[model samples]
Target: MHYLFWCKDNNTSTPQDMCWVSLRMREQHFPGHVLCWVSMRMRDHLFPSPWQRHDALRAEVGAQAGAADTARETSTALYPLIVRQGMDKYKVLEEWRAGSFGATCIVKEAVGDGRRFAVKKVECIDEHEANLALKEAMVLLNLQHPNICAYKEFFITWDNTISSLFLSLVMDVSDQGDLGGIVRLKRQLVKKMDETVIQMLLGQAIDVLVYIHKQKVLHRNLKPSNILLKDEDSFLLSDFVVETLAADEMKLKIRMDDECKLWMAPEALQFSYSEKSDVWSLGCVLLDMMTCSITNDAEVAALLQEIRLDPVCLENVLKTLVGKVGYSADLCQVLLQMLQIHPVQRATAIELMDVPYVKECLILVGSPLSGVKKTLPPGVSDELYEGGIEKALEFMQIYTDFEDAQISALRHLSWYIADQDGWLCIEEIIRLVVQAMKLHSDSLDIQLEGIWILRDLVSQALAHGLNEECFISNELITTLVRGMRSFLPNTGLLSQICSLMMMLSANEVAAELLGKAGVLQDTLKIMESSLENRELCLSCCGLLWSMAMTESHTRREWLVYAVPVIFNLVLKHLHDGQLVESACCSLWILCLKGCVVEEQTESISWALLESLHAHPQRPVLVKNACLALASLLRTSELAAFRVLVPVSGKNGIALIKEIYHLHSDDPEIVENMCLLFSEMAHYGDTRPEMLSQNMGPFMREIKVKFASTEEIVTLAESTLSKLET
Candidate 1:
């Protein structure tokens, strides 16, 4: 029998690649025959056009026809089948799997729609096998459950050598592959599967079994290979084999292959089986999954042998194993009941569903909040972290009430989501936490947790350049600012609040909202009350720096109140690098807008220069210090002179030269130094000071060295021209 798979080449004008597989059975001298599968790849001539193509071929030809005639005749004969089965609407992408019995190929909608399906082909040697394959397809067609693999439709085709059954199974392409594959892969990662996941898998497996039993059907092949996982939390049962059950005879004899022996029940080996027989196989599957978690396969093999030797002692062994692996005791008991040696003693699927372990597992697996409890694998890559946060957020959206446990869970989950950088800036999560804070205003813990969550989210967002539309909402900003006011006296809470405010102010729209919502005043109050707390003061300084970067009106409002406070903080905390750095950053932004007067600029510049000299190695302080000086120098002539003059026997020119020499490698520092020299050259008095200090030679050298850099070259040229004039 020849099976062909065709895919349209959308990139070309014609279909260039058509794959064919010939499954020829070996000749036998006896009445009964054995099938030996051989797959050979063959490609045919390109079809004329996509519209006029054969979907599939099921011919009973005694002689080979010409390629042109075969194509013409097949297109005409298969056109009705293509339309009836909607085959033209889907094109074969590639073969997923192929074996003696059949093949599975991936097919996608030809209309460029995103829908995909796995199309399985079953080749039957005779009429009996065809009937059995059709019955299996019919059984799958009727079964629909969350844990059961979905079946779309089935069709029949025939050739002189064989009849084939084409079944479309609507299933997600499992990238992680089957349960057995996942177990083996996890073994390599050396990461143990968490018990919560095990319990959840067990519950889901039993749930599907229960459903199938209710419909009076048996999943004869119950093993890890047959169980497919859509994701970490979703497992589906697949590969159903249809068979009859005798009313009086509880057992039906069947061939037991080596693969089947691994999961087949003992009673089934003795040719006596029932629904409880499936329960025994499920026990074996559970054991397989549990043992797979062991990093050493040898240990798993030995453990399995021990359980097989003393079936009744399986409970004790499982208990020890699960306990060592952190599985719950309830699950141990459920496994014990399911693995009972006698068929009558084995727990039925319905009874298994009622088990406490199963119930708890169902709740945890089904609950959206359960994702928060999962222990992510080690080295949790950025992709895994983001996926976890997305899953948690999806789960949180389903529940509204702010119960104590739920609130606490959300608080910790927020920490986890915020623990990593590059969060996708989920606005809904931010709004939900903000609403939680508003609703539970009385709970200080909830408020603090919510505030920290917002702080981390905003920090990551700003760091990763996430959009600011959702964060700048009136309700969120207003709620946060109000929380800041209410939590004023608490130093830790106030620090986080200030930090969050700083990040929010990074966005112009958010800054406008914060300024309008009285965040400026509330922050001032926090600074006033926490004057002695350097952390709080540092955080407030950072917040003010962000606020000063907003529109001119907002910058002016902040400068009016921030200038004096910042100057005092700088003078008071000259020895503290962090406080000095933050204060300098704030002053830089304030002065950039010409918001500082001559006296304030002079005092702030002198203090900053002292801090810069004290902490020459601090890159952040140096960068901010240079920026502040440049801004002050560019403000006005008087402001420039006030800041340029010597203080405490040290000249401002000398200090600027020292900073320039010390951190020449920093681009921002270099750019700002050039700008300061340019600003100084624009003034007549400082122009002589520049010449006296030999600034002309330095400016010429800078101009040549940074010729490729526009900002530096432009500023250097302006300084040299002014100096020469």
Candidate 2:
């Protein structure tokens, strides 16, 4: 067959120097409009029919003699190349993209099924690079998300003539072309993509990213061309091999062409990336989708370039998008979140999935691993479901088997439960969440998200005068304990587990359930192992306090060992007022439960007194410290003596006096303060210091100010008699 495929290039006038040799290739290679050179009359005279004006003009046998000469002159056909392995073969149909060392081609199976797939042909420097490429391809193959173009197969071939080696990867193809092509098509028509379309597209993009990132894979090179649109409503995130291929193209320099740099995160340019770097690229892609219709491709690229240099200029693009039809303010705001200049400030893939709109988009038009999402009941879809908590719950229920969807649903639900207030059927939400966690027990991310979301739901229940009875079931408790046992010493996972345990420990039955599941054991182990982690320690302390408050699980033999853990937390984080407050509360309850013996007395006294001196103005810390110190003194005369010993320019008596004066307005503090003094007078050493600090006057003030408060008046009168005598 003879063909005349005419194409033009910007810098060269040579007949053979063209974008590509044919139709789709032209679109794939060229970013600008194709130009025709024939004069109007000559063109019309030569070819009257529209078929003659196609991308390639097929010449009948011997009809156009010059066609053979033209083909020989331009030997740029990258297709028609064959890959044979044993009895199987693949025909390369076209080249989709090309760099110095590699090209991604459209390949037809050329047998049996005769289906099409993409074949990335890479020229490796040696077997080492070839091995690395294969390893990366394997990693990408394992990604296996619905919106990620799956890898079909891979094999290696060598060019014996030049002693060069090639790596070919077979991958699934999308129905539509790449996102860059769609954006370009929209630009030509001058029509912006609708928000629902944007949501669906961006939603799938975020979903793919979340899945890959959780697997510890980073799509360091994310651009429109790499995102393959399946059809109008869906797309596959393609080109996981981009960075590897790009590196091989650059001879291992790890550089991107200026065009690709437009979609790159700024930190990525410096070889720094987290999941957030991919976020920056997704942000750039979002901008391209939103602004492509109104602006030319070059203008959009320039805008992306400008944002990399000046991320604040992202607002300029948002301002333009705000004026464009079919774009929502939420879209604009989310775009801003993605484009944050600092990687820390930028939202991650999972974080983006947490956005409710994005989650809805994921359910509606995003790729689903199994089948469709549960349709909202007609009434709910029309009237009640405005992308609220129910849709989030439904998403989890429908895609319960999909780890990615569950992760996204749980994250979105975590925020929705807080933002939209409470779920009308939170009980159902709880059931689904428990089921998700139990199903995805292997996924640390899912477990963390489920536990975190459940904590928030329980917190909301507490805020609205509800109990843990509804939220905390044996299944939930057992699942939590399993999560604890599954991901031990992961301070983040441990911290969240403890937080939820703390909230549920209020109900005696719930507390006993936790105790039975070995939750208290887990808490003690975490507190011991993670004493330096202030946040985890604080959670452990708080959970221990709640357990002691319930009175049912306090006297367990293992409870006594937690006393020192609380003391160490206090010592380690003396400056952290919240940690100190929570720690003191734990010590107070433990002492009240007889868990704190005389052996732990001095450290407990020191932790309580120093916590008071460290955070005198912290009302909760002071009150808890007073209660803890009063407990210690009531139980041990040695503790009473230890408080009187001055440390950090303040003895226990001075610390108590200062706390009393500073928080005299708080009747709880006054009552706890009186308890401290009465316990202090039990030891003669602490008595003089208490009297010297004029404890009598503070007691009189508490008596007058809180005269109607029975506890405060009784404690104050008793303390005044001891101080005066």
Candidate 3:
């Protein structure tokens, strides 16, 4: 076969260069098909006579033909050429650092273009390491994101003298250096970063991870040192070493490298890695950033060392620092999910992006939510409510065909109907909403909307004193419980579900039904999972408080789980007045039922009293704590002594007397105060402490202050009589 090559010149008067090449010679001489043998041969053959006289002209013609052939060959090559400007093109300005792989140096164009770059030189110890370095270069080449370090080019240099090869990767230079340096500098200066800055950096990291994961790559070596700061406001995820996943496998086995163990997930530490492992590393990086801002490098290292000793301690430390660092509740929740010890529970990049805190951060950084927000249809509200039940059903059916529209409409309609009070609780409207929930059982949006609707309906039912049984049935309660379990990790939905459960719990029969349906188990899980979500915790406590009002068996069943969780909540959120009040109220109910264990009684007594001492001005917290203390005392003399012993040092009796004097005009506080003194007077261990204080005038004042209330007057008189005896 014969092939003809044609070339066009900018000068039309110049003849088009044509070359005829034989296929036989082509295959033998150019196995790579990179050079045109005919062009080289023809130039020599045709110009031989004029070569000596026109050496420059002949050389120019050969160069033009070679350039044309190279262009054509490059277009068809299996891999694009590296555009070799050779190692001499870059002048090493400074050695940035040295590592086992090789040295990273600051370099600029040797031609004096003044453009700077980072050149990483990897020494190939063996063929295997060389292949690995080449693979890493390929992985970097495929990545393109603003938050990912940009791969400029790569080249291989051969040294015949040493029989060795070196791979150099050129990347855009980051002016601000790696995140580790920034964190270290900030730590040295004792500079505290705004939560928003931490959030923005985390958001950038997530964005890069999401993009890389979507390309089916795992950044096995994610760490603060691998995150590069492009500028003060920009960060880039760097040094990604790809670990290919088998076609049927979701995880890759990784060798445990001692240097990376600190940031590796539990599973990764065991030589297994997945996208979730990257999330775990990302979480570690986040902690490192936050920790550096608040403390020095030595303390941070010590804290991380402690965490390595006990992985579970990470959660506790994070919880403590979350408050100290003033991180948002949503941000803390995301961090917890990311750091789950079990890889199965750890969040994926996709799920992490959906996290509320992440989304908010993205919005702040001008990355809009993926999809456009759907606007609610006008007149849908009027058609749902005032237009009558049939009109509402007809309007809702229209949205069923469009899921997003349906969810948006349902959410708006539910709130609208809920705002109407009990007037919108007609049978037809209730049935329609229930049917919507059943139809959209698999849709999180619809289910969330259904929860909001049910919440409103139950709230209306409870507020109106309607027969709760008439509105909430066992089947509906079961469905709600299932929804709670399905969306258990969503704190917003969990809060709404807990709110609905609280309303249903107001009814004795409903409360028992919820308990039987494993509502207690689900609520406990929410509490355990959402320790950072104060609203969810408050709602869960309210639900438990209502359930604790049920029969003794049900209350006892709840007390076992509720006590520790509520105790911890009280201890963690001592400054939150509403949370403290709700938690203390639940503890009081448990005590009232005499269901609290000896250990729980002691723990609750100490936590509540400490909280009471911390925030004396919070009237509701104090009242509930006093009532819970009274309940504990009424349970047994041992419980009464336990309550009094801790506060005895600060003149426990004097604090009570002062409380009575401060709020003597308040009926509930006075009543609870009288009850506490009456119980303490009955206990031998506490009676002396009670008598040692200024009790006579305090009792007389209480009795006189509560003269209008029979219960207070009787309790106060009885306490004084006991003192006299």
Candidate 4:
């Protein structure tokens, strides 16, 4: 079947990339359209059409009960399945595993990028089963941890040959294989599993379980075969079948094979299951892994089965386990807690995380923060502080798919990096954050955490007077802009991203990179949408000001669009002094960039003066306001006349006088105020407005008060000369 698909995909198939959109497309469909395109003999086998659906079951019973188990006995090589179809047609490379109701295949994309994926096709015998299958697959979709296999896409189709409905799930492939395969190999070679390897597996798996159970979902099938090896140091729990077993009856499909019975909790055997059942199953998998060096598969299975009849036997078996290591005794104790026969007596995955040996594994895995609540003792903190960074990096590298872990590790890494000495690792942190963002592109939380880590890195560099080489890089600037583009409307995220961009813009090279990435336009878009969010506008204004310093060409198009919006925001958030100050800084930069359209200058001048009036006591706001007012008048002659009218009962001159009186000791304010008057004096229509407010005396006082300051003295002399003339 695969050979036939290869020939057709290369020679006969048209519509190169059809996406499976039907599962989500009740109103519109490409999901069903995808199934149709991937089917080799399109006329023979049944597949969903663009609008075709079996909303209700046509027949209740399967054409044959117990047929799925029999179907798995035959070689799937003779009947390869497409198993997946989406933005690209997936070509099944090999039949990885066949199950009672379905099969998982190793497949490569036939179009675009050629990425590999594992596609599982579950045969849903009827509409009800198909619906339940879809609901189950959706559960997997929500269970995206670094330790759980990542689900990509899924859709339901039909197989007319078997008269069966099939739901296909496409997930990320862990090429190294599953725990069962490794255990079997180690047993064949009589090699013991490394202690660190055991810790990696159990720690990561329990972490995954804690997250899953908190979400109120179950792994359903927790065995060595389901625990896939992502790499040497990572394991992913796969195949969530969503079997709903009640106290009396099991609802979903299950094969009562002997292997399943060997690992099942006694309560699970009685058709009752809970999260504790998963604990028992995981313990069995771990036990098998531990004892595989000395025991055969048959012997382990028999022992596991016998434990159900006599729970006391587990302690004896643990005592004789061959691969005992430093934490073996404690781990065996924890395993005893997990393998308890009664659900009420069993310790949950969460409780296991707190055990000494388990916490040691979590720390060794560089995930010290997941579900572990007590404050670390000073000894542990010191140990972690000294060696934790690399372990955290390892944790991130090993579990790249795990967003929660990524966030926890990153946040903790940030706490460790509070001092200047830690700033040197900014580049590595940036690289990891970028990679994590790309892997979890759809995760806003990861994206938020990534941006925050980058921001914290930049902030420490700035505060500590570190060189640009410490944090600013082309890649950092690009990621910042990319985040802005990706989450434009997420004000919480955008506010942080915008703030980071503002920090990056301080460096001329970093600012240029942002300019090239079209950062200014994104800032304008978010500011317009988030005018009501004071912090967002404040950060956006700061970003625009920084960009304007080195990006006049980039600012040319966006400045016009931003002017009215900034003017509006200034009026809306005048009570927020910092926001008002930022708006003033951004407006002046726009004026210097030659961005004044005469239609906007009048409104811009009024907003600046209003900011001064609203926060005249804030020295920084007064200083920025004076400079912004001067730049507006110097650039647009019309602005001088437009701002002559009183605003909030104070015209431009009156506001400047009040600001001068309030900030008399501030030389920056005195200098910029002189510049503001000089610009006004050059304009005939507004010059008397200054003189009539006793501007001549004000200029002399500024000149005398700031005589030693060259820029201030020059500005004061110039303003006095202009008013006298």
> Which candidate leads the pack in TM-score?
4
Error of 2 at 570 (Å): 1.2
Question: In candidate 4, which residue pairs clash?
Answer: 19-86, 20-31, 21-30, 21-31, 22-31, 146-402
* Among all candidates shown, the one with the greatest lDDT: 2
Error of 3 at 97 (Å): 88
When summed lDDT is taken over every stretch of 10 residues in candidate 2, the lowest stretch is 33-42
lDDT for each of the candidates?
Answer: 0.62, 0.69, 0.64, 0.68
Candidate 4 has an lDDT of 0.68
Which residue runs of candidate 3 sit more than 4 Å off their true CA positions?
1-390, 397-405, 418-422, 461-465, 552-555, 646-649
Which ranges in model 1 have alpha carbons more than 4 Å from their true place? Answer: 1-403, 415-425, 459-466, 470-472, 552-555, 642-644
The digit string of per-residue lDDT tens for model 2 on 1-725 reads 22343334546543334322433322223222211211000122344322222112222212222434544565422112122341147777875687433577787877789888877777777645655566466555444455778776666665555556577777888767788887888889998777777787777787778767876788877888888877767788876654455454345354346786787788876666678988888888888888867788678878887886686688877887787555777888889899988887888878776676666676675244223433333343232235767788777777766677777778777877877676456688888888888766677888888887887778778888875566667667767877887798588998888888877776655776665455677788878887878788878888887775543333356778788777777778889888888888777667655577778888788878888888889888777677777767776888878877897976667767766778878777777777777777766666677777777786787789888888777777887777667
lDDT of 3 by residue, 153-264 (tens): 6665544456554567787777777888877777887776567778878777777777667657787778888788777777888766534211112222232334456677
Residue 373 CA displacement from its true place in model 2, Å: 20
lDDT of candidate 4 at residue 483, scale 0 to 100: 66
TM per candidate comes to 0.44, 0.46, 0.46, 0.47
Kindly give the number of clashing pairs for every candidate: 0, 0, 0, 6
